[model samples]
Target: MKVIKSNGEIEDFRADKLINSLIRSGASIEEAQEITNIIQLKITKPTPTRTIYRLAKNLLKRTNISSSMKYSLKKAMMRLGPSGYPFERFFAKIMQAYGFETEVDIVEEGRCINHEIDVLAFNKNTVVSVECKYHSSAFRASDAKVAMYVYSRFKDLEDKLKKKYHKKRYEGWLVTNTRLTIDAIKFSRCYSFKAMGWRYPEDGGLEKLIEKKKLYPITVLSIKQDSLQKLLKHELVMATDIIRISNEFLENLGLNQRKINQLKKQARALLG
Candidate 1:
């Protein structure tokens, strides 16, 4: 059977690939193989990759809830925004957790024009200007145009920094919640700009970075949508934010002790 990829391309379905993905999401090898077998039986026609993902998620939910939660990380990220602004804040928090001093939505005068940086991160040795591409749709990808634009903006800033701030070197990074187009990846590599997306770069993609840092968004917990929205409205985005919130505050929001404790447990698991 053929499967439609997230990029809208068609390819032959590979059961092994699906199994491997489940395994990466913390499923046991036996469970992964079992899920793949069931998926193969259920496929009647050309299926979208999203459908396959949903199927796997449902199966994982029945067998292993923890793995299902891990697999749904990207969906949680998508839930973070109707606009990209909230995602920028979440991204800055993630960077901060990793020991980088970060600033969001800062405007700086470049050599040619003033540039609005999405996230500016600096340690002692290096400064990075990040262009955060947040897409609500999982299938949509950041394209070469985005890469080119960010590269130009970073170049402008880098040139100015070299002339004035000669101590620290500047670099460009384009980060996305979904994925990048082939041309975007190629252009980034050719130009030496760091381009990272959901699964791009293989080892150091956004998902890998989040897992490595244990910096999960609060949306990953199994909570009611309205309650989650309330938390988001209060600017509580990360799972770690739950630690600071009082149980009484959650009770005032209509959560009982049982539900509140469950949410905290999920947050702790994701954070750890």
Candidate 2:
């Protein structure tokens, strides 16, 4: 059977890929294989990836709620944006975990004109100017066009950025929630900048980084969407951050004891 990606591309369904994804999301090998079998049986037609995602998530939830939450990471990233602003701040927090001093929504003067940079990250050795390409839908991708445009802006700001930060090295990073086009990756390599997306760069994509840091978002939790929004509004974005907050703080957000308890349980299970 064929599978329809969010971008409308169709390809033959591969059971091994499905199994691997499940295993990566914390499913046991046996569980992943079993789930893949069930998924294959369910694929009677050219299935949309979202349909497969929903089915897989529901099955994983039935098997193990925490694993299901981990599987929800990609979709949860999509939930982080309609506005890219919040995603910029969220990504800055991700960089902080990487030992960088970070700031979001920076307005910097370029050689040509002023520009509002999405994120500015600096360490003792390097200063990175990041353009956050957040998309609400999985259909959108960061292409060569975006890479070119961001690099142009980076070029315009490079001198001022380097002068202000006084770092030994400078980098321009294009960070997006979705996948980057192959051309974009090629463009980045040729330009010596960094490009990161959902599952590029083999060993260390955004998803891998999040898993390594246990930076899973609140959207990955099995909570009401409204409550998710409430948490996001209060900057309670990371599942890993639940360790730092008191129950009283959650109560202040109008979450009841039962929901709070479930939230805590889910967060702990996810961390494991």
Q: Say which candidate scores most in TM-score.
A: 2
- For model 1, the local distance difference test gives 0.86
CA lDDT of every candidate = 0.86, 0.86
Clashing pairs in 2: none
Error of 1 at 45 (Å): 6.3
Candidate 1 residues lying further than 4 Å off, grouped into runs, are 1-12, 41-49, 162-165, 251-258
Candidate 2 local lDDT, 1-272, one digit each (tens) = 89998779999988888888899898999998888888888789998977986898789899998889888899888887557766787888899999999878879999999988888988889888899999998778899999999999999999988888775588899999998998999999999889999988889899998888888877787767777677777777788666568889888888899888888888898887
Q: Rate residue 199 of model 2 by lDDT.
A: 85
Q: How many pairs of residues in model 1 come into backbone collision?
A: 0
Candidate 2 stretches with Cα past 4 Å from truth are: 1-12, 40-49
Q: In candidate 1, which residue pairs get closer than 3 Å at backbone N, Cα or C atoms, i.e. clash?
A: none
Per-prediction TM-score to the true structure, in the order listed: 0.86, 0.90
Question: What is candidate 2's TM-score against the reference?
Answer: 0.90
For model 1 the TM-score comes to 0.86
Query: What's every prediction's RMSD, in angstroms?
Result: 2.8, 2.3
